[model samples]
Target chain A: SQTIHQWPATLVQPVGSPLSLECTVEGTSNPNLYWYRQAAGRGLQLLFYSVGIGQISSEVPQNLSASRPQDRQFILSSKKLLLSDSGFYLCAWSRGSSYNEQFFGPGTRLTVL
Target chain B: AQSVTQPDIHITVSEGASLELRCNYSYGATPYLFWYVQSPGQGLQLLLKYFSGDTLVQGIKGFEAEFKRSQSSFNLRKPSVHWSDAAEYFCAVALPMEYGNKLVFGAGTILRVKS
Candidate 1:
């Protein structure tokens, strides 16, 4: 069975602080990874996706950036966090095939104050 | 360009009543549709997906969705509602290009089931 893991299930960061969120997948190889942010009572907004290591495609250019340092390991970072950067950040993994059913991680709830 | 639309922002139903959520999509090619559920403070879970060969697809947690090519819709249904079924539902359509893995999602439908 494949499983995705995210770190810092809950995070509270002050404004203008650096941020880092990590996501990793187990039991799968060369899986596509994605980062999504869901606003309160709103839909998910795709931030970034990676097909392979060092191949990150950002959907929305904002204060956040994503990097695939290695296969199955993705990182979301921010140089300086803003109030708008606080949201429920979810990491997902899908097979490289056409089926592409995304499996989500536990998620990280970020609160900026 | 491919896009998904979930017309219902909020839906309320009784515990034992049949529930249906409407979803419409727009795409040039045959769309790959998917239904997902998200509980409060949890990640989205795939309830069902429609690729081909089946108009009606059954998913986990006793949820089913029907794909109508004519209407460009894939509506989700549950015969009987449960309090546990009260959650946010999302409709997604996969892009039919070289980057087929990327999906475009709708605004989502929030379900509130009364006891």
Candidate 2:
């Protein structure tokens, strides 16, 4: 069975600090990866997605960026974090087809103070 | 623009009672619909998806949703509610893009099961 893993289950960062969140999938290769953020009272918003290595698509312009350094490894980073960047970040993986359902990781809770 | 609407922000039901959560979408055509659930501080789990064929789709955790084209709605229902069912439910629509499909999620409805 395939599983998705995310690091730093919880994080507390000061404003203007650098941030990095990592996600990796095991038992699958060349899977589609996605990054999403969920605010306190809002639904999830897609931040970025990658179909392959070195290929990342930004769904919305914001302070975050994503990179696919390996086939199954994806990283979400920011040079300087903002207060608005505090939220629950999720990492998901799906099969190659667009019709496939996405599998999510445990997620990372980032509190920017 | 394509969007998903979950009318109920929060719902409370007694244990073993019937439950229904509403969802509506606005799109040019029939798009892929989905239902997901999220426990507090956890990621969303795929409950069900509607691609084509039957209007009613069965999902995990004894959940089912019916897709009504005329009304542009896909409402989730459960015959009996359980205390463990308390969670946030989200309705999503897949918007096909040039590169890939993007899922637009609703504001979500939080279900509170009272025993």
Candidate 3:
């Protein structure tokens, strides 16, 4: 089966600190990658998605960026963290065929204080 | 633009009772629909998906959903509820081929089971 691994499962950073959240899938190839954030009591919001290595599409503009250095490895970065950056961050991947269901990562709970 | 609406924020039902959750979507074409479940502190799990075929789709954990294009609704149902079924359910829609398979999700409806 496919498994998604996300690191630093829980993080707490000071304001203006840098941020990096990693996601990697272990059982698929050429999968589509995505990043989503969910504030408490809110729905998941799409932040970024990648179809392949070096190709990224941002759904919303903010202080974050995404990179796909390898087929299964994706990274979300920020130069300076803001208070509003604290949320549940999830990484998901899907086969680039039809409307294949997306599999989500365990997710990282970020606390920016 | 593509959007999904889950009218109910929370619902409570007794065990062994029938369950139904409503979902509605807005898109230009035949939107691809999906239902997902999320346990506390876990990622979203795909329960079922509707792409192009039959309107009624069966999913894991004894859950099923029906797609009604005329009503722009895809409602989820369970014949009998169990305590283990207490979780958050999400309704999502993917715009045909125009959006490159991006899924737009609605505010999830949380389900609570009464013993």
Which candidate tops TM-score? 1
- What local distance difference test score does each model get? 0.91, 0.92, 0.91
What are the clashing pairs of model 2?
none
Off by over 4 Å in 3: B96-98
Give the Cα RMSD of candidate 2: 1.4
Model 3 agreement with the true structure over A18-104: per-residue lDDT tens digits: 999999999889988999999888889999988889989999889999999999999999999999999999999988875767899
Q: Can you write out model 2's per-residue Cα lDDT over A1-113, one digit (the tens) per residue?
A: 99999999999999999999999999998898899999888888889998889989998999999999899999999999999999999999888776567889999999999
Alpha-carbon deviation at A89 in model 1, angstroms: 0.2
1 or 2, greater by lDDT: 2
- Looking at model 1, give its docking quality level: medium
Worst 10 residues of 3 chain A by lDDT: A93-102
* lDDT for B95 (candidate 1): 64
- How big is the positional error of residue A55 in model 1, measured in Å on the Cα after superposition? 0.3
- Candidate scoring better on DockQ of 1 and 3: 3
List the DockQ of the predictions in order.
Answer: 0.62, 0.58, 0.65
Give me the displacement of residue B106 in model 2, in angstroms: 1.0
lDDT of 1 by residue, A1-113 (tens): 99999998999999999999999999999998999999887789999988889999989879999999899999999999999999999999988876567889989999999
- Name the best candidate (by lDDT): 2
My TM-score estimates for the predictions, one after another, are: 0.98, 0.95, 0.95
